[model samples]
Target: MHQEGTRLPNEPVLKQKHKKRPIKTLFLEADEDHVAYQDSTNRFMKLVYVHEGYDLTQPRHQLINPHYFTGNYPGTDNEELWTEVLDYIDANYQPEQVYLSGDGAKWIKNGAAFIPHCTFILDRFHLRKYCKRAAVGIAGLDRTLYQWVLPGQMKFIRDYFTVRFNDLTVTASQLQSLKQAEKYLTNNVSAIKDNGLTAYHGCSAEGHISHYLSRRLSSRPLGWSSAGAQGVARTRIFQLNGGNITRFLQAEQRQASKQAKVTKLDRRLHFK
Candidate 1:
């Protein structure tokens, strides 16, 4: 009821509207909660999404309800959060291969390892983000190869920059920047042009974050406790996934009324 915006478009709907369709692949995305707190302790929270059935061949899927987990939880590996992500996909979507693309964090890499049949594609959005920072070293090739960059031509670009760099007599700093840029690109060459690697092209995390989470939670000035934060997140995600809040409340009331009747019957029998 306290939602900020007036225009929440329940517009784009998932393909498997009725019957379940086996997912060919899925994309995993994790984002941080900027204002996470546990009673003013300044704790951290992560919002992770497991979305499937979005490939270049087909229409993109709607936002699947996300899984929210608190960071620094007890009794788990570092990959605990992502492990849960894999589990969520297994239970619901049953995709054949999960195409993972996200931050190049150790934990994210480890998540791909967790899934046996997972293909790790360095999401172009994140890859280009780092590329931009390191691009200064590559003679600002990002500007020159603007179109090529999106099409997954980083290897060609890298080779061109290599030759260009060797010819130029530059300062150590410039050389270091070039080397850094080259290494970053070289390491992620396979992930470049991921659309060729898989039917689905890019990571939709940025857009989803804006539409689902940030627009309501972070962009506004609302504060939340650990429970409150997680609650709103789960609620909003469910709404995005086509859940009706009114029907949900009615169902809860019905269940509560049924439980009360059962309790009264048990008490009457005991008294008799």
Candidate 2:
């Protein structure tokens, strides 16, 4: 955890104590999976961070597990879990900017509140799903219209809101649904504008969740133990974040070097 935080030097610390360096954005996504244990159910929530444009040479993360906490199935409140994850990030990876993207989940929304300065964007694909569903309800679910209008309407809705979001209100019958969609675009309006809505912007986070986590764990109805689930989830995250077997070996080498130096110092001090 300490190493994670040290990966990016804090601005205040750098300015006052150490020289400031560039801080990259951390793209984060989280989801909960229901795993059945022999006696009780375990709700395993996995959180992953992908440093923007991370490559094999410049690895940004040392650990890649979703911070896991145990709770009952279909639990109502996840404040504690969110708090723990946020605290972990705050302590270890003091990111200059955090970009969170995910499906509309209550816990995800609540988790954003903990990181006040972090920018939040909705998963673009998920946003399109909502738009398609709404359009289908209005335009009827005919196969041809579903295919044509869904993509076109999604683009239209995104553009329309981009220009006139502030002027709009929740007039749809499903007010709750509309609000959830609005939160993503409206929460960080300037960031959305600056970042733009190109295919590359929001899709990476969604792809990470879909390809790395959901496809393997949540695709089917399976159960997991809390410890086992977290361990596996973390391994997957590390692999996705470019923390492969070679990186682990490199980290091990660095740790051994540091330990050996400390041991030599101790022996010298004892002799003196």
Candidate 3:
């Protein structure tokens, strides 16, 4: 197999662009996996997928024509990644509005710059996670707090936390959890409220990362070199995207044979 020197396999490219068409609503989910390297450091393989929407008719909800992009797209700013997603969207579908859902990571939120008429939504999983953390040991308050989140009643929750810390006795660890939850909620209050207002099909980026990335990349007790991990990720994506490995290898072999002949001919001419 021909491998690029210490680099990932080329990023996946569509052989032929999808026929242009109009789509009313589109869903995008972005997330990353923390992959451990043999050198004891970690790298992130970012993932983003675009789908028309979910199909409720199936017993298990399925995405309609989902296209996935995965790689160690190095950088804190995800403009390049989002630009690819935007280009795919523009080529395939004329979407009136695009809804991007995630855990409100800055990188995920940065997608707004590239995706026009986009709305950012905080996934319920993270919202519930922090809400439960904030209301830890407050008997039924977690449920209440979640309901409050739906209506954007964050101030009440904040005031309740303030009162608890000031008037009530709490362990240092418990106070830390509360503080963390408060900070998360405060930072993403708008996203939380947007979740309530928008017609959201819940974000499954976490589940997708588990299925697509974790199972192959980081599930077992194994470490990989940066290039090896990236290569595996790109292969996994190719397989997931329905690429035929046998046909691909045959094509590569043919191309390699042709390149070899060209190089041989050039060497003969130089020697003469």
Task: Tell me each candidate's RMSD, in Å, in order.
Answer: 7.0, 11.0, 2.7
Summing lDDT over every window of 10 consecutive residues in candidate 2, give the lowest-scoring window. 5-14
Q: Evaluate all candidate structures by whole-model CA lDDT and list the values in order.
A: 0.59, 0.49, 0.81
Superposing every Cα of model 1 onto the true structure, what RMSD results?
A: 7.0
Of the candidates numbered 1 and 2, which has the greater lDDT value?
A: 1
Measured by TM-score, how close is model 3 to the native structure? Answer: 0.88
> Which model scores highest in TM-score?
3
Report the C-alpha lDDT of model 2 over 30-125, residue by residue, as the tens digit.
Answer: 555544543565454444343343342535432232332222223444666556556556545556777666554666666667664566555656
**Runs of candidate 1 exceeding 4 Å displacement:** 1-23, 36-45, 50-88, 91-94, 135-198, 267-272
Q: Which stretches of candidate 2 lie over 4 Å from their true place?
A: 1-20, 24-26, 32-44, 53-97, 138-200, 238-272
**Residue range 1-272, candidate 3, lDDT tens digits:** 21432232233444585577887789999888999989998889888989888888987789988888877878778777787788778888888889999888888888965699898888998899998998876877888889987678978977888887885678888899988988888888888888765467788899999988899888987788877877777777766767666666677779999999999999999999
Q: Give the alpha carbon lDDT tens digit for every residue of 30-146 in model 1.
A: 545455354555433455566643444446654444433323222223566666565556556767777766655555566678876777676666666656655565556566554
Model 3: how far residue 103 lies from native, Å: 0.7
The model with the greater TM-score, 1 or 2, is 1
